[model samples]
Target: MAAVLEPLPQPDPPGAKTSASTDASHASGSGLKPIKRLISDSRIERIVPESNAATHLQYCSQFARDFIRADYNFCAAKVTVARGGKIRALDAAFRESGEWLGKALTWIEQHPTRSFPLEHEVIELKITHPLAGRLVRCLTQYDRIFVRSMEVLLAGKIQSHERETLLLNAGKRLKHIVQVCIPDNDAYLTDGTRKTK
Candidate 1:
């Protein structure tokens, strides 16, 4: 089975310092077409197994890693695995401590028919300089992957609009997350309302 932390080509040197502008440049060249084309695996059955959730979860995590390894050649670095159980120790790169995390929370809330306790899981692939911006820009893309994976896992059938809706929802969610990360003075407000962030 593949692990979720699949490696990709390094956009910048390992441990290289980064700035927002550099990240934007890398992100701009990330070739949205390629990343978008590498849609979620149609073969994933579920995040957790019906009989043995832990064993199955581990198996799935490893499988996700393998899938990433096979799919993204320019990934530049090993992916990171952060499960709901591990949320308290999130990386400090994030400006806000608990923002951009509703994905996991929502997943945990909506999980159904599981015999064992399973929290949300995030398999993050670090985007090197320049590419980091691309990651942030395209962060919402994963919403489709998450939703589709869950649909297939529990319903045993993929919803036609699940991907689109997920992507759209991701955009909304991500904007909120970014807003939260930005400083109050630097934040963008529409019509005196603090957007969803």
Candidate 2:
């Protein structure tokens, strides 16, 4: 005759708290009330608008220059690859250009104006500014072009003529960006006197 074995203990049902467990939780201070966190107000009470504007303008100008350089390098790489140049050269060019693009994109993403339906007046001001918006748009377009160039370069399936067309389009965009950033010196006189055409 074999002795009968006892059934194994089952886990407690969900939401069913035992007295020992509850006592242990209280002992561990888990039952204490949560402390209130100090939250700062969203108002821009202390910030100077003029200083902020100047800083943003300076940032936009610098970013525009960097973006132009990156685009130029990437386009150069594309052109080189398209002209039956070495892949090694294209790889080096792409690596440098990619670094610049990455930094620009990160800055754009972190900017307060990046959020939609601007709740703050300061953000609205930046987003509406001509230079700020223009730079953002140019950088965004450049990002798309960069992706396409990478795909074409890696796949190596596109014809040489097709690559040339892509390069031409990129060059046109780059030219437009450059013209916007750097106005014609002849158009603006250095002195107060107007230049006689």
For residue 89, model 2's alpha carbon misses the true position, in angstroms, by 38
lDDT per residue, candidate 1, 1-197, as tens digits?
A: 23333346459788888797765565434222112222233222222222221111111222233333343222212112222312221222232322443454355346453333223333443333332233333333343345345554565443547544554554454344333333332232433333355
Best-matching candidate per TM-score? 2
TM-score of 2: 0.28
Per-model CA lDDT versus the true structure:
0.35, 0.35
lDDT of 2 by residue, 58-171 (tens): 112222234433432233222222212222223333444445545534433342322222111011112213233434444454544433443454455455576456545544
How do all models score by TM-score?
Answer: 0.25, 0.28
> After superposition, which runs of candidate 2 have C-alpha atoms over 4 Å from their true positions?
1-128, 184-196
Output candidate 2 Cα RMSD. Answer: 24.0
> Residue 120, candidate 1: how far off, in angstroms?
22
- The C-alpha RMSD of each candidate to the native structure, in angstroms, is 17.4, 24.0
The true-versus-predicted C-alpha distance at residue 91 of model 1, in Å, is 13
